[model samples]
Target: MNDFTFLLPTKFVFGRGVTDRVGAELAAAGYRHALVIYGQGSVIRTGTLDRVLATLDAEGIEHTELGGVRPNPEVGLVREGVALARECGADLVLAVGGGSVIDTAKAVAVGVPYEGDVWDLFAKRAKIVAEGKLPVTCVLTIPAAGSESSASCVISNDELKLKRGLSSELHRPVVAFMDPELAFTLPAYQIAAGVTDMIAHIMERYFSSVGPVPVTDNIACGIIHALVEEAPRALADPRDYDAQANIMWASTLAHNDIAGVGRNAVAGGRAGGWECHGLEHELSAHHTGITHGAGLAVVFPAWMRYVWRSAPERFLSFGRSVFGIEPVDAEADGVDVTPEEAVADAVTATIDELQAFFVSMGMPRTLGELGVTADDIPALLETLEQNKGAVFGDLQPLTMDDARAIYESCL
Candidate 1:
């Protein structure tokens, strides 16, 4: 295991009716003014927005709101949020929706104190200081992206045709109210895509080249197993509280840097990076209409197909642990195969089964389903190169050619 430090400062108020605690938490923290941010109209439609606002009013906390945060959140709205928060003299950033909303709130929170444009942070031209960012809180209506507790925020710039992410410990929310019931009204497609995104978050850490960090590996696999098992239940019955609750908690744990600790080589630890996410970001960046999680569902299997050879043992272990695939199952009687070949067979079956799961959840396996054609591959690669550079991912250190091959395989 690589050396690591795990710090999760997000205080999660989870379970039924936890949404009511949003105001109390804010009051206790001495936040008098909030800049509420939400996506489209789901929260309002569900009366969740009214409930949250009522709580704030009961506590006498002043507030202003910015609505219309869409999936693959845009930076323009974030700039508006920063401006509105500044205009309202807001002291806290409160997001009342899912990942995209929370991500936008985080961007706005950091942007409020910075003099430069917020995209500059995503562009790596400016660094986020923990003390410089306003406190952020959440009323999570979705169980994916884990932005509530994660130090990461992803924002898209439509004009630049770029989708970029910025990570800082400061980006983590101060508090998150997770009531599974809040997600009951979500469409089946959003639920499936959310599950896929949460699972991919774990996989990004699980596939690292770190080590025999069996404890962390076990944690990652357990979350993946829980997500895989519970996602279907939630999809079948969105009102299934247990299933939704499991998925909701799993999403928070997946990206809070707990399962990822000692896996990523931050501060010169080891070899492992977010390879699939890097590739998927370009896909979503090019086609803004594509959902981030759906794009990931299309990209992850192809990435596994391309890079499993680079870390056969990791894939084999992942298959065995996450999918319960046995090496013996890959062996044929009277067929003397090399160990590498045996592992490869098991890994291939594992990847195929995973892709099958995505399909079963109504996810598109090909880029064409996402409206991405072979003609778009060049632009995708160019943006990928611009964002990720000539090489990325410590697992394999992928090049433009490798990325092109992965995109082609998705086709």
Candidate 2:
């Protein structure tokens, strides 16, 4: 195991009616003014926004509202939020939706106290200090991206056609109110995509170049297995509280650095293990219509096919333990297959199993299905270079050529 330090300071309040406690928590924390952030109109349509507003009003807490945060949240909205929060003299930022909303709130929290432009933080020109950020809390209505308890926040610059993620301990929400009931109305596509996104979170950390970190690996595998089992149940009945609860908690654990502990993600000065996220960020950055999880669904399997040769042992172990694949023995089974062939078969089977699961969840299987073609690959590569540079990943560092081939293979 590598040397690492892990810290998760967010107080996660999870249960059936925990959304009702948002106002009381803030009141107890002595936050008098808040900037409430949310997405388009889901919360409003479902009456969740009204309930939250009522609680804040009843608690005598003043609040300003900012809405219309789209998927792959934009820096423009974040800028607006910062201005609004500053104008209202908000000491707290309350996000009332899922990852995008929470991420925008996080960006606003850091941006409100900064002297420079907020995009500079995403661009790595500025650094975020914990003391400079406002307190942030959330009512999670979605289970993907894990921004509620995560140290990372992603925002897209519409004018520049770039999407960037900034990670700082200051980005973690001070509190997360996760009520599974809030997710009961989500569309099937959203549920599946959310599940895929959480799975990818663990896979990125689980596939590391650093030697054995048995504890983190076990945690990662267990979360993935639970998600794999519960995702279908959630899809079949969105009101399945147990399934939603498991998935919500799993998403939190997936990206909050718990599964990534003891791993050097910055090895070689590259964002080593999160290879597919780098690729999908380019896809969603170029085409705003694509969801983050949907893009991952298409890119992850193709990436596995491209890189499995570099670390067959990782794939084989994942196959047997996670998917319950039986160990292959040449002599015991009286088979003619060589050891290399057996390993190859297991790895291929693992990849196939993952692809089949995505397909079962109604995820697109190819870039073509997402309306991305050979013509789009050049622009994708351009942004990929801008965001991720010439190389990324530590398990099998990928050059620009490798990325292009992976893109082509997906199509």
lDDT (CA) for every model shown? 0.89, 0.89
Error of 1 at 236 (Å): 1.1
Candidate 2 C-alpha lDDT tens digits along 176-289? 999999999999999999999999998888777766577887888899989889999999999999999999999899999888787665432212368999999999999999
What value does the lDDT take at residue 71 in candidate 1?
Answer: 87
Which residue pairs show backbone clashes in model 2?
Answer: 272-393
Q: Which stretches of candidate 2 lie over 4 Å from their true place?
A: 265-272
Off by over 4 Å in 1: 267-271, 329-338
Per-residue lDDT tens digits of candidate 1, residues 1-411?
A: 777767789998999999987887799899999999999998998999999999999999998989999988999999999889888999999999999999999999999888999899999999887665789999999888999999899999999989898878788998999999998898889988988998898888888877668888899899988888998998899999999999899989888877877776774332257889999998888788888889999999999999888888889899999898856533565577776677778999999989999889989999989889899999989888889999988778899999999999998
Model 2: lDDT to the true structure: 0.89
TM-score computed on alpha carbons, candidate 1: 0.97
State each candidate's clash count.
Answer: 0, 1
* Residue 238, candidate 2: alpha-carbon lDDT: 93
Residue pairs of candidate 1 with colliding backbone atoms:
none
- Name the top TM-score candidate: 2
